[model samples]
Target: MGLSPVLWQFLVHWLHASALFPAEASGIAPYVDALYFFLVAMTIFGTTFVAILLLVFSVRYRREKNPVATQIEGSTLLEATWTIIPLAIFLVTFVWGALLYFRIYDPPTNAMNIYIVGKQWMWKAEHPGGQHEINALHVPTGKPIQLTMISQDVFHSFSIPDFRIKREVIPGRYSTVWFEATQVGTYHLFCTQYCGTQHSGMIGEVTVMTPGDYKKWLEQSNSGQSLAQNGERLFASMGCNSCHNGTAAARGPSLAGVYGSKLTLTDGRQILVDDAYLRNAILNPSEHVTAGFAPIMPTYQGQISEDGLIDLVEFIKNMQSNYRVQQTLVTATSGEAAPTTPSEGTTETVKP
Candidate 1:
């Protein structure tokens, strides 16, 4: 009991994190600290052992001690021992690190989802309940929260020191990171990458609260609808329903039950329907042309905002798990039937 405080002080000092970053407030923090401490201890021991050997050899084998030089011969046993021991230690380190890497990257199925978009100098986080926060995220303790992140402009890294987790948000692609807060407190959020002129100011805070408090916080900020609900409205406004109405004669393939499923592309390559693939198919329909469909859809690169795109993706992902499309669409916002135009009926298709 008496040594507890001293050990705690030593650990805090050795990590060099306790002063700046908060105490371990995440499930993975302790594990990360353990691995880091182990490596540091090994390094210190190796350095001290080598220094001691050098000093002892210099004094014991000095010129005056023997007055005669003797030929030194290599010992195979000693050489083998040194080589094998280091190799074993390295292998152990590798395996331990690999397991931890997977555990950190691969989120559990029960984890909650949060979408984050990184721009030039700020972070945008969106919750399922339609709560939006800029540069600040609120989450509950004890529940796993998975962050699906992407960059809107230059590359940015989302780092939280207290959580011992960081992930790069790159443009044109998605990156994911997850953590479970073990304590309720505020932690620092930083963009480790130097993004732009205001990179230093690109900082935020993660407010972790008790489960009850988190629920209340969300309720207070909830926008009265879900992301998927908003996406459904946006999808209608975009005139996608005119082609992807999920009918027999509909030009586009049915999106129901298509997410996470495999489908072949027009280029004879099979690909899984994921968030990245869906986003690309929507923005660059011609490039990701469907197998049977003609490549006639125009690009929507500038038409839809990033937030709109995210909502649409969520809608498609949650649409018809057991197969459901509440209503069929015939007209876009223009209220004109697109399929009736027999000539040059080329349009966007979200096939498979």
Candidate 2:
């Protein structure tokens, strides 16, 4: 085949398999692109104007030829004019940009929440229903999806070029980004931050599908098989059950009912036991010790790895709702091992 024929065939294949523009993927893309263009135009205009003025003045007022030129005093009016003009321009840009920004930040009330954990060289995603994907994110077209992101290791960025949305996933904190995909296709996911040696290798894909197709995918993804489930298995494999068992007076507090509860510190300070806290407690046990609990928990710091933390957190959160079920079993079947109640006289104490 001729070169033109091969090129045409390639173009045809891409067109049939891909959705290119904002209209094809999501309605929000065009607005984001427009804002980007506006900023670019303003920067270009300002730079060009300054460059031209410098060139013109240099040639017209050459030092040798204009040695006797009149030295005019600065005018307050000219200074005021320049300052006011630039201020007005900035105000206008600020207002426009703010409007667009709020729109992006304010997610739809009905949007589904997906948890994203960014690690060294991969993106780990999980839906509320326990559907998990590695290095790939799937969302339903025409429905807004909010991603709650956090870094498992170092800082990383979750960016979708087609949606023109990106957010930094910082360690020890949660960051969120949301977008509604208008079309159904695969879009690129990149880590814009230079995380480590494998930063460039951190890439993924966002697959958008129709509502019906999304439901089907969700069902398949959650068919009793997922990373979240595997994480539970891994937790068991690591002997985490020994300390976290509900019925035992184990070294550490029971993992049951620990998530989303207010944990009182030794100094009478209260901290919410959210996902981030749970993860940190696992990776860096020395960071925050429970009020009455001894600092005997081993630091899984580098040994457990990033993926291990995600699995551990998922396992802990999953046990939250089912904790009561296990509590009853513990009391009835394992009365001797199970504590009848929480530690008595467990008043908060300050660390010296």
Instruction: Judge candidate 1 against the unseen true structure and give its global Cα lDDT, from 0 to 1.
Output: 0.83
Name model 2 segments beyond 4 Å from true.
1-24, 44-71, 91-135, 148-157, 168-176, 191-203, 226-228, 246-251, 254-257, 303-305, 322-352
Error of 2 at 234 (Å): 3.9
Residue lDDT tens for model 2, 225-335: 444555665665676654555544455677777877899877778999876788788877877888887777787767775555666776687686544354454457534
Note the Cα lDDT for every prediction shown. 0.83, 0.75
TM-score versus the correct structure, for each prediction: 0.86, 0.66
For residues 208-324, write the lDDT of model 1, one tens digit per residue: 999999999999998876898788778677877667666655677778877888878888989899888888889989877778877866678988878888999988887773222
Please name the candidate that would achieve the greatest TM-score relative to the true structure.
1
Which candidate ranks first by lDDT, i.e. highest?
1
